[model samples]
Target chain A: MTTPGLTQVLLAGILVVIAIAVARYWRLPVIKDMAFGSVRGFVQLVAVGYAVRFIFDIESPWLIMLALGIMMTVGAHAASGRVKSVKGSFGTCLAAILTGSLITLATMLVFKIISFDARYIIPLAGMIIGNSMNASALVIDRLASDLRANRLAIETALALGKSWREASQKFHRDAARTGMVAMLNFLKTVGIVALPGAMTGMILAGADPVEAVLLQVIVAYMLLSATTITSVVAVELTIRRFFTRHHQLRIDR
Target chain B: MAVTGSILELCNLTRRVGDGTPARAIVDNFSYSFGFGRLYSIIGPSGAGKSSLLRLLNRLDECTDGSVKFKGSDTREFAPCELRQRLGYLFQTPHLFDRTVRDNIVDAQPHLSESKISRLIQQVQLPSGIVDAPVDNLSVGERQRVALARLLATQPEVALLDEPTAALDPANTEAIERLISSVVTDHGVTVVMVSHSRQQVVRLGGEAILMVDGQLIEHGDAVGLVKNPGTPQGRRYMNGEPQ
Candidate 1:
């Protein structure tokens, strides 16, 4: 039985305090969900840590790809639930999440900065997939909210013989616009404002300055690709499902 | 009299929706016709398919077993947007757009003459000042009127309203009832409205369509239905007695 280090234990404690303070300050209704989500995240990371240790040493490239597949699937699932309320566009979440993860993951692997092993593969996959999940969810949630908010305009468009896609175009655009903000910020502030965990870890492991910078650049660029793909795909696919064959909204009449 | 119509028509219509529990197959083997320049009030319980039948005209929900023919053409035959442009439907609780009232109406039919739009706003009896107001700033009555104005802007040959006054005060209710009459008579738009209130049915001055458990029990002559309802459900509805 391997015991966690003192720093690891302290970090967990600090995370709990941070979560509690944030929830209280934001007036979050579900403190329990926040706590459970945080705890579950930490537990998952720990399990992945050991699993990556074994996989990285196994000398099997397929397992590396398998980890990426798993990451994309989970991200897609998260995106689906987040955008389920969006009419017609729920199916779009899968495409967005998977596409986003693939573009980001592919670019990183091709660049050879992180190396094609589970140690880097799993962690990096986790980060890109996690970001894709959030971005796709935001796209779906924002589209649904905007559609409901602009129900009159949409209905009027439908009444005017506009296809469902045409009616919901504004909503899709607005949602995509709002969802991309986070990814855009990450793109703008990648080097000067913050050092992502992966590059920092490599630096601490005695990697050269050029290598760390190269790795960071690849990660930043890939994340941008993934999030952009997600935002676009989710909105387009979801908007398609929102209307009937006659170009009317498939809402309760 | 069984009304003959080219405004809105339901021919051999039967509707089934969902899959048990969440599934509802309330309307079955029913046919009705609505004519131009006539106002129709449909009164029934929650699952009576009053709303479902109205939706058939807009193709929002389909009839499982029969065809809904509008103006002698199958609803499926018309392009949804094209058909809907000439057919307006309003929800019980109006879902107002988050924009100014002018945009809400004019944006739907951008090419419509400005004079017709001003006439529609005036016809709905909405104040001139409310036309530029944001949808969120308006009261429930105001929202419903704006929604109605938007619908009318499409120049619909038929107007389908699902309990348009469900969320309004009595003053607003009377205003909407008056608006319904004004539209049907003036614009020659056929009206099909769902109402749970018998008073609204009486006040709106239309053929009373008494529906119960998704079947039409009584149709035609609102005064006659109230005076001597042929079906038990119709009598119960008129008497305000539990069915």
Candidate 2:
């Protein structure tokens, strides 16, 4: 298969135009968002493509690490926006995504599953950070809402001599599960229901099917580890915001 | 009513819900002392902060402008969990864990023996078979009993009951009142209960503290306070006037 030219890429504009037209004709409220989102996505991806190309050319470990850091920070910011109800959500998202992405990437390097090359590390880190961001956001959002809604049950347990951790244990487990449910579903239906993005992209780019499958397996494992770590960390961090050192629920914020 | 040694004391204990000039003080400048091994009933109209004061005693809600002392020590001195264990609180609406009655009790006191669990069931006047039943399957009254059992399982020195019988029918209310009496007489637990009904307060027959608009309007013997209130606010409350 040959690489598509810029003209071919611009041809995809027809799909966006069709979507915007349908949205307008239906008088949907999100027509503005759809139009703006299409433009923003196009700009952001094009910018990232250039940045990744430059970083790959450098092949410096320091530069690669810096790029990964930038990606995680941006991802954290985006994730934090999803949970507007939580205070200090940016810090929680950053910590969780950092912990999740770095640990998974470090493990892959140590185990020689992937090298420290910019080509492999950059793409892999992007995948881990993306998944981790979603996990952290989901965990924090669910935990905060659950704690707020069930203040009576939680306070009753706390008043019954249970520690803060014990009082919110069920919500923590539930929030963590909420974060991972999407990933779990993805894993369960990976190839049968839909071919995952990485494998499909690799196959479409003329890679051997067997090799693409092997790489997809690695991506799956990487995402699972990242999402799990991010979810647990997010729960731990987010729950602290709702409790005081005295084990009281602080929901006023 | 006796001026015996006190188990808990509230020194101008106050809680404010919001912030602004003239903040809304739920329990304002409230000072009182509860004696050991006695049931004290707090009667007030709705929004009079009876439950707010009870929550402050256990540090369930922080005091905005005062302090609570338990056993001659500031309540803040104790770890909140340890203090709560020592001073258990039963919410008006009993929130039992989504589990069996036995599990709810055990969760409160993990090392509780089977015999003790059975005794708690008996003490709360719950049927023996109810111990094995799921909490969702129990009636509201039964759930309250289970909550009481759970509170007892903690072995608290003081029990703060926020309208423990508010949602119950007369029979269940009487039964819980009997349990409260037994809790004080048999176990020597200090009880602080919040009730809107003046009759229930008199029937419980303890010291009654009448609060109106977050201030203590009057306090004296429960029967005397109901029969003859010292303040106009208390009298109006007894007359069923809107606060």
Q: In angstroms, what RMSD does candidate 1 have relative to the true structure?
A: 5.8
Supply the global lDDT for candidate 1: 0.77
Top candidate when judged by TM-score against the true structure: 2
DockQ of 2: 0.84
Error of 2 at B161 (Å): 0.7
Q: Which stretches of candidate 1 lie over 4 Å from their true place?
A: A1-67, A74-94, A104-126, A137-162, A170-181, A185-193, A207-214, A238-253, B1-5, B21-23
Alpha-carbon local distance difference test for all models: 0.77, 0.92
Calculate DockQ per candidate and list them: 0.36, 0.84
lDDT of 1 by residue, B1-243 (tens): 233455566766887766687467678777788877788888877778898787776876667777877777777877777777777888887766568988878777787677777887898888777777888898899889988988888888888898999999999999999889988887778888998887777777778888887888889887666667898887887777777
Off by over 4 Å in 2: A20-31, B1-4
Candidate 1 colliding pairs: A88-A241, A88-A242, A89-A238, A161-B81, A246-B80
Write candidate 2's Cα lDDT for B106-144 as tens digits: 999999999999999999998898888988999999999
List the TM-score for candidate 2's chain B.
0.97
